[model samples]
Target chain A: MTDVPESSRTLPKNSGIQEIRLGFTLQHWCLWQSKETPFGEFWPGGEVLPYNGGRADVSFFPMMQSRRLSPLARAVSAVAWHSRQQCGDIPSVFLSSHGESQYYFEILQGMAGGEGVSPSRFSLCVHNAIAGLSSIHNASYQPYLSLAGGTEGMFAAFLEAGGILLETSKVLVVWYEQALPDAYQAYLATSETTFALSMILTRGGGPGHQLRLARRPGKGGSNAEDCTTSLVQTILEGRRSAVCHLEQSIWQWSLDDA
Target chain B: MKNLEAELKQLIIDTLELEGVNPKDIASDAPLFSGGLGLDSIDALELGVALKKKYHIHIDTNSAELANYFASIKTLAGFVVSQQNKSTL
Candidate 1:
């Protein structure tokens, strides 16, 4: 991958907003229910409702090679399964906080016990496992990124994906997280065990879609919520989801819903 | 045997992140894979690693007797204790 400086690359002037279709949203959790199943029951009670009037065709159990697959890999599988219906080729953005937390925990435990950490776990501990998995699954071999931004991981990923869509024509953005074991959970303050959100964006005005960009005026205003929640609300409200800038407080609501 | 089974069940619950499951909920001699605990292959691999780490009992995946060992938490703990006794001897 070539390194391109953000400042050097000029964004296209006609980077007009386009209506990217909500293809599919897959969620996985460890719990079983008669009503539905997630990609894996890694996170129970997780919901993915799309506005375009489609059932969340979720999967319940993890894949066969799930032990080998990192959290990001599972997340990408959810996204890829949904994106198969639309165009196969597109830029992708992956986001996760405790990326490979289980592996990290194992490595730490090994080190504490005077046993060397596994080389395989060390090699895969980075934040990009999901992107690699997605690329392999789609056979796209396109440029993608894995991002970690603490509690704001999902929002940051959304912003980056939006930027990619603005630069290129369209992009697929996925956000996912796996619950850390209790020992690790005490180390990192996080809530909502596991969650994954995927959205496809294209440039060209279409029906029932919009994007907004703005800046935060000051603090002590509305508390921050993860981008996943916003996207879910948008879909639930029957409005197109929007991506807002990280520095700004922008809201993307469907005018039709209003 | 019942006490050992309960302890093994708790260990499985703690190790496998089987949220909402308790030692009291699991029955001794119940099948751990499909019928009892509903654990998958990944869970087996993880359990294998955990067993080795905690009990210092190495499980040969290729062993035909491996299924008997992992039949249930009760069986697994008994296997571990037996291995421990053999090592001491």
Candidate 2:
């Protein structure tokens, strides 16, 4: 923790067109799924560690404050709290492709029915509402960024975390998404179950597994793997390398044992 | 008046999503904001909307007595009753 890396570590050297590489350490991590079973159990060939499903232990916030948290928020807060207990307060990066879509659908439905929106519901329907609530309840005034990176949200979050690590000792990264509303299900392929994953990322040589992310120009494999679960399994199993293909880029995550 | 106070208490709890709180736990005369219950401005707005929808009462947002009207469950109950009486007359 005493060592600090230069801010230019992640800067692409060519400055024109080339592969991008960023490295960081995963200090502490927690994963929570909505269903009582691991998501991999439902979808074969992608088994990861089993996770429990239950109420998020957000007792840290008083009844009044905690009550406003939607299920997605609760899961996000639960993982964030667990990591904070292990790695102290730090700036956070929250990533979700569809943040609070279910809640948004409810608000829209209420409006369409002429029922008028509940002020409480309207207030918490924004994209960053969960992150804001978590930061408040933690009493953490540290800088936080919320992003909707679509298919590349996780990779984008890691890039953001890596950038922050260059100056700070650690950065908390929480990626959580809820089940998409049925109306939009036909258009996109996403997980039906809600899940959240949180981890502390530090400058290259922290007290946990070291990881390297390399982005190259080209298309990735056609087969789509659930990034969230696959990522958890990769780190837990200490896998050497895992690859994910975005629309025009190929991103590879590997253990930086060197 | 007592019944209205109880109903207002429930409304506050529901509107604010005050989990694990019983209506009886809220003191009728205690302050709702920055007092015993520790509610904030957001709760005030939410409670105002809930009160309006349920009781068909309009709370003047810019009125000088706004703070006094939302002072507590008792005050809210009294306000609702006054609004109802005005409509009837």
Top-TM-score structure, candidate number? 2
Per-residue alpha-carbon lDDT of candidate 1 for residues A67-165, written as tens digits (9 for 90 to 100): 345444555565555664465677787776667777887888889988644444665687786577667666676788888754333556546755676
Give residue A29's lDDT in candidate 2 (0 to 100). 72
- Please list the Cα RMSD from the true structure of every candidate, rounded to 1 decimal place: 11.3, 6.5
Clashing pairs in 1: A18-A204, A27-A39, A28-A39, A28-A40, A29-A40, A29-A41, A29-A42, A30-A41, A30-A42, A38-A59
What is candidate 2's CA lDDT for residue A243?
68
Residue range A35-58, candidate 2, lDDT tens digits: 665233221112222344456667
Looking at model 2, residue A114 earns an lDDT score of 83
Cand. 2 Cα-lDDT:
0.75
Tens digit per residue, CA lDDT, model 1, B1-89: 66767767877786666656778888787899976777876567767766777777767779999989999867887898888888888
Predictions in order: lDDT: 0.54, 0.75
